[model samples]
Target chain A: MAAARKKETFWSEPISKVDLQRPAVVPSGTSIIDAVKEMKYNQIGCVLVVGADQKIIGLLSNGDLMHEYVGSTLPGDTPVDTIMTENPFTATPALTVQEALEIFHSNPFRHMPILNGEAIEGILSIRGLMVFISEHLPLEVMNLPPDSSLIATHAAGE
Target chain B: MEGLKEYLTRQDFVSSSEVRWCPGCGDYAVLNSVQNVLPQLGLPKEKFVFVSGIGCSSRFPYYLDTYGFHSIHGRAPTIATGVKVANPELSVWVVTGDGDGLSIGGNHLVHALRRNLDMNIILLNNRIYGLTKGQYSPTSRKGQITKTSPYGVLEEPLDPLRIALASEATFVGRAVDTDPKHITEVLVAGAEHKGTAFVEILQSCVIFNKNAWTEVSDRSCREDRLLYLEQGKPLIFGEKRNKGIILKGTKPVVVTIGEQGIKKKDLVVHDRHREDPVYAAMLTKMDYPDYPLPVGIFHAMEKPVYEVELVKQIKEVTALKGRRNLQGLLRGSEYWTVSNKGKTIKRSTGISSLANDESKVMDERIHALLKSTDPLTASLKNTIGKIFYDYDYKRSKMLSPRDSIASAIALFKAAKIECILVGDAKRLYGILSERDIIQNVVLTSVDRDRMPISSIMRPVYEIMDESNSIGDVINILSISGHRHVPIRLKDGGFGLVTIRQILRFIHDTVEQVEKKESEDK
Candidate 1:
């Protein structure tokens, strides 16, 4: 099973190749509570806040909602922009997962927006990135040749 | 699970809060209907939450005995959304008025509908702001006079039903507050619906907009003006059942039944299950005087509700990917762990090499200052337990993490203290020393407005303990190069000690020695 599993470099793959969230987008001036509801309802990781022209302005996640609303005294009625991380650090669609790793180093972003010029392509969550990398990394790093290694065998499926 | 009789009663949902609405207000009827319908939900009273925005009708939550939140104006839908999303099991309800829901909260309302969350929304269309005494509302009729539009309302009035229809709300209905049975029926249906249910109540504001809906809702004219929609039935109304609606190529034509070859078969059949929404849209647009008003469910269709989809998606994603916890996200990176012999071993791989900037040296300095401290320092031993108490110590002021770094820096300069304790309005966080600020803010050139004081706070363990003598304090000031020594007070508060204070003590002792030596000479 270990021999059957394919090994891949995390940095070499473009972020677009990995599943990026087709974000549930909400308009600016939207309340934080409503924005979070949109994210929860759609099961979307992040709700991208867009301007009047539908350009990305901000983004809110479960973590942001927890910190900004659940932990704070601010009412849920506060506008999305008020709690949303405005103009968050974004990566271009052409950027690789390795580049994403480097970007995370500086920005510490768990969820990074992928932009194709002015328009948003999708969102990349650290969970998705790490999970994908973990599947590929476990076997090769162990350096044990093929056959029934329990951890490697379990991670054999793509 | 709960017993039916234990948590199910109309009185169980009644709140102790004083009912403050004006007597004869339409809100009273809607409130009664909600309380009655709640018992039928079969959920515990604690599982129910009524959220309302600012307005006369927004006060509905306060009168409810169950958990409720009186939220901001025009933001009830948003608040209710939090309550529902955080705990989908909770039967969340939104109570909002015409001005609060339509005018100020229109964005939240439409989005909530579009999302099709599993929650009931009771929109009270009173046509005026009764709380503010008298003001025209968004649903107020065109050419109506009020405090805001005394010259008569110029803009065409908004139709709440039409808005709900366009937003693709799963359940949309209208009922009159004057009719308790009808209101209860609609409210129960809304509560029973698995998706977002919007019911607009045509409530009469006795003081501000008196009899706004009385023309259509009055007993004498109700049979003719009001049209009760029933599934798979012909569109018929009027006291004698004489009036019937027939489609003239999409336009509804009100004609007399059993006259001019107009039979019941010729009437348009109400198709609640129609895939197309043109009929529902038209039905919602119908108004009194010209057309009989629709006072039942205009549209109720099955759609995958938002909360359900969210939960399903999360499960699917979690299965596909892996679990990501909150703490990993907070400190800004995923903490890698390896299972060894059934025990998890955490790896200390930081987020990229970029974080190791020039601050690496300062980080080492900080670690040394914090870790190298022993229980007893050579500078002072017994002096702390006895003599140091005689010296007056200044307690440092604390700042909340929410405060901007710029304001904290300005405050630090004015306070003349080398450092300040950083925390909330209460509670003592780590101390923020001038050295920590100079290293992170000035040397690194970070954004002060965006940065929080918590980011550069000196750890509590690094602080000088009350047991340390003045000698130990001086040693700390020299080694750490911090003018201010934030010490823990005996009462569990934070106090500051400065090099200037120590210098003053030294100068006074030297003066005393010189006078004694001169007298002996």
Candidate 2:
């Protein structure tokens, strides 16, 4: 008989796979306030700033809003291009889970946009990593390993 | 002087960790009660252990001077179970909140109680997820407005007391955070109980779930709206003490005293230790606007503690057989060996398998030479080689053909790691973490299940062209406090550069200048 098993599936399986096609574009001249409002309406945390030719330029997250407008003295209507993260990390659809995990560990941001060549594809989240971790690793190994094992090893060495 | 109370002072119980929660959080009252009751029990601080699930209340462990674990979400009971069974002498307490305990951790809570674990579980029901900012919790009343529930909650809320009694909890009680004296009294009683004691404390989340329970919590309205239950006393609540509950047929009926010619004896008396839970369940449901809400011990009974029973069973079995050594258990597993270890196979893909390919091997030798001569070109070549070789077209298509999911996960993890640099974002324009996904989707159990990546992908912070001046990039990074910024290439595609990379670039430039000066000298 088959042993009972907790099914393993992608964490993103629940959320619709995000599309990066056409890349949600905002003009560089658009105000950060308007960008933030667009983000809110879209129910997203960041927006891509684009040039007139629809070429990708910079990225802005809610974090940018907090620093530039909420926390700082800057006006909300300040242009998004002034505060957007310029030239953000890009990944193709062909990237593996291990490669993506390594990038996340080495880089910053809990989420990143997927790019297909110059165009946006979709986004990924840390929850996906957690789901993967939950399936691959035992509960005890998920965090720091138990301290008793270290003590036992020390005794053996002594 | 010889009691546990003598060994502990209110300050002695407090840990050195700074209290970062908002000032008026109900956690303060709960903490005060635990500290006050601990000394009275005369247990040494070393003998006491506190386990907590995640939330504002989960911070209980950090503030306590004793040994504690601020564990992951909704898993405190499981951890506390491990701690208790490992060392039965330690006095264990599990501190949880409405969201942490009732919503996510409900399964663990019920099982622990049913097994009758000897622990005092102080459930602070603030009715909102305070730590995550005002999201409607499982305990948040229907129609309550919250950060996630802009239109108000349409789902029914779980009643903790009813849940506990239904689960056959050995001891069940309720208390108010504002009533410090009563809270302390109930806590001491809960701790003294031999079996699992589930005490639900009606707490206030002043900011997010403001006035959520105002009708029952207000002091002026409490006398009329709240019903304080005591063993052997008539069920009564009123400003003049004129109102009381009496049995009409099988149901509890609220009535006025003296005017109806009904004496206090005619009123329903609370029997806390009753073996049957039917009456207790009824009392929990009585939340009348004009009647006092019931508080105090609703149920109490004796049962064998799960830990003690487990240990007892283990000892009995061990007596018949020899005790097992830790070393033996660690290394005694059976092993298997495979025989087909060194066979080589031909590759069907464009590249020849290592065993069959000779020209491919010569190419690697030349590649190594190029790597040593030009490091940058070698790195780029190596990246492309690795990407091409590792690509799995079939699995990639099945999992995420567009690669949007993986990219989003990468970006979210990056943002969370930089949390110290970026404060909380109350709103989401694009996604940053899995928490954002769970909060926005899974909690509501919405279906985005099989749709393509483009359907869910939100526009995240933009990437700039590599031609963009380093100074301009630095200005954006410093202002946003983002360490990793995606660099958009002029032609297309992108490259990621981190703050560390920029700093390293500057350091490298300075070293180059110093070397040139030394050579000139």
Candidate 3:
């Protein structure tokens, strides 16, 4: 039965096949403001936190920053680690694409750090994964149900 | 036939002006497509006139090697109508953006389309105002984020195709900028249409609002998302051409071809030339995701072309009236010219000689003269102050610079006044009017709630002294292109003198003159 298996599907492929981007990383002691600037400059949705010895410590997403710093009394110089999610769910390079998708589907976080025995590889965003999959099955990518936002509820007039 | 060199080429349509649109902008593709299509139309390059309103897309006229008019915002349709009406032989084309065409220009566009003028109007809809730096435009999708709509747009977007169909546009089509070949085809078809041909191009402003038509323009999904309407083809779409749309009890339903015994004939046929636009209007509502966005001519019906009919009417009238000239109309048969030797005017002699004759005959002659003469001409020499008092003109209230534009607009709306003096009664600064708002504030990035009235107020250029005659007021008003003028009072203040007030004064004088003439009889 094992020998009868013809070809491996896209879901059974290694996580590396998804081509995860090199995650934007900042030192644990970096300021929240600096982290946000890095995220904006890199045009990424989140930044990964690393402690001394270059081990992944936490993950700071735009949503995390928005909920933690925005409209709050926290000073710009406040450390990012205070607001970041510690021990974030991570994937391994050896993990199958299906495993990564399952983690994203079950978890609330949008970004997952890819780790290779504490030596960081990259980050895998749910959107990035979806885009990769869409390239394979382009037709099914946009075959979504109607978005309510597209429909005009009221007359467009003054 | 003339030599091949005599015919125009695509190179002939390229202008010397440098294309200044942002790199990767959809307008570049559209411009190229238009240039390619024009040479194929077989018309003289000089006969084409491209009129545009204000926007990034409005810059199309400068890049095209033809007669072009970059008219004012939202007035391109009106100017294009005039261009077509005046020169029916010329092929007129109006280029406008979503903000320019669907917002302030909405009324003009509707009228122009409904009139069925022999012109082509291209509306480049990028969903956002790229010229104004990404403000929510009239076609921007609800919940779409922009500079002005940081929290996302609240109002529903206006569908340009639906509006055109509703306006009874003789030719209405849609095309995306990404597909240059398709756009060129649609444009050629539109140019060939005899009546008003309105095409809304789904363009992308790469810098401000990128991928605005991604659902329909993206190479990966375009085949599945866009339904290319052929003249007699059935409405079908999808990568495999398996999914088709069928009308079920007035609602369009997507069905599989072979799954439930549905065939190609069951799909809605493309009937663009159908007289009634009800079917075409339904196609406009079939947007992306739920259904394929229909492109190509959604509706095309033969109608009496405005310019052709107008020229015909003018010709018929001229034949009936024996071609009367302007000089003949201006100078009636009863004109009296006084000689240089101080001779008595012919008409004036009649008035004097009538006194010598019967009083009833004098009254009759005066009444006849009054009928022929303009009543306003007699009051033109009267001082503006006297006219103002005679007409009981109300003093226009002055607004300060500190007032918000919103408040100024409110004042204009509530008071139903054309203009307001932007200063106190003591010192004059400038004037803010509805015209100023329309020309400056509307469709611009100016925040009416935050910006002060002084920001848009025009400095008073034409000022008339209260002692100045009404004749002087008319001269100033005509030269300044303003409907109202500020009258400087002798008591160190200003008064608003309007053309309406002057006309009212003339009307009252005419009534009095007529009453006096009847009393004499």
**Model 1 stretches with alpha carbons more than 4 Å out:** A1-158, B1-7, B333-521
State in Å the error of residue A5, model 1: 35
Reference contact recovery of candidate 1: 0.00
Query: Interface RMSD, all models, one decimal each?
Result: 25.1, 20.4, 36.1
Task: Give lDDT: candidate 2, residue B28.
Answer: 87
DockQ of 3: 0.00
Q: How high is the TM-score of chain A in each model?
A: 0.75, 0.66, 0.80
- By lDDT, the candidates rank as 3, 1, 2
Name every residue pair that clashes in candidate 1: A11-A98, A41-B306, B15-B65
**Model 3 C-alpha lDDT per residue in residues B190-253, reported as the tens digit of each score:** 9989998999999888987886898688989898999999999988888999888899988998
lDDT of 2 by residue, B230-295 (tens): 888989878889889998776788888887698888899999999999889888887756345788
Model 3: CA > 4 A from native: A1-158, B1-6, B325-521
Question: Which prediction has the highest DockQ against the true structure?
Answer: 2
lDDT of 1 by residue, B399-443 (tens): 886677777667666665455777643466677765455445423
Best of the candidates, lDDT: 3
lDDT comparison, 1 vs 3, better candidate: 3
* Candidate 2 CAPRI category: incorrect
